[model samples]
Target: MPNVVLLLAALAFAGCDVFESSEPVAFTRIALPARPVLVNGTTVVRGDYQLSAFTRSVNDSLISVPTIDFDRQTVLGVFYGGSFHAGCRGNVETIEGIRLAGDALIVEVGPLPDLGPCRAIVYPSDMVVVNARATSVRFVGAVPQ
Candidate 1:
């Protein structure tokens, strides 16, 4: 039994790839729905996702969230209307860690700035915020931006 354990450990250690990557991972922008929120099976942006920032500038509070969209279901808009980046979070910053593995789209979102200084905006047109990064996102395809 102990010999088997030692053999497994040795194999795992030998499989480590120290030279796997040498470049910074870029989180490519994903194509999402104009109304991409999915509550149960219906599309609706609720909870923390129900947010808005008036100006699409760095001065605005960062909308740091994981986005989930339908590949064939959510109607893809040719033009994206809003802008929210880590630059907007002032002292704090956010990064939507969008990744592509095989056909999966992974998003690892950092923390967001406090909503105190943020001037509240309504949903729909004003709701041009990024989907706050959830625990995990299961997706496919890629749109580098």
Candidate 2:
């Protein structure tokens, strides 16, 4: 009887949410966007902002979600439950938005955001911000597993 009780207890512990992953399994096989792959300095305007693809990096199997704040002059390459803050190397005057646009990374720029120091990260992923004078920046970079 004690043996059966022990097995039940073990099963209960294994069934806890803590033992499960928070992110979806699809993230492991997610592919990088392709628009940034065709970056040629062409400007794509939306609303009142102008967008451009200046740099990109792609991951093999690892998933890296891109996050940027022109207001804070910061970009986060998030993956494996950790946000690797790095991207943009120039003066970020303003930012309208940063998100994935159908496998493509799109950034919308406004007049200008506050000026601040640029942070760059190279490990596990690569990110960068180019042309402080430009209004927008796009990335097709990937974060491998």
Candidate 3:
């Protein structure tokens, strides 16, 4: 009788642990400025943009490896041309990473090993801004002097 009661109590506790609620997680969205910034000679375009930042979550299960998934989020930045579109290969001194998100494209500068080759987007009205950190860049529409 005592063992049965203990087992029931343990099950109840486990159930509570499984059913417990957690606070909602929030992620900050950063908008690319209207002005383009140049970092390390690489030009980044600024506009309403979205990119994938990789992350993983695990579930409690046995006899199976943890599954990996991707979460898609939107980031505002200028659209930069892609290497495939530009017909270029290898490291291009200015561009670093190019990714397609929805209808917009993202061109990232600095160290992004995961992202493939990048190409600068050239628009007749596009303006460029240089980054002081030398690690980031952005492209945007014309900025008022």
- Best of the candidates, TM-score: 1
**TM, every model:** 0.27, 0.19, 0.19
Ranking by lDDT: 2, 1, 3
The lDDT of each candidate is: 0.31, 0.32, 0.29
The positional error of residue 114 in candidate 1, measured at the CA in angstroms, is 2.6
Cα RMSDs, all models? 13.0, 17.2, 19.7
Better of 1 and 3 by lDDT: 1
Residue-wise C-alpha lDDT for candidate 3, range 1-145, written one tens digit per residue? 9999999999999898555442222222232332323222222322222111111111112212122112233222222323222222222222233444333343443332222334633211112222211123232222111
Better of 1 and 2 by lDDT: 2
lDDT of 3 at 8: 100
> Which window of ten consecutive residues has the lowest lDDT sum in model 1?
72-81
Off by over 4 Å in 2: 15-67, 70-145
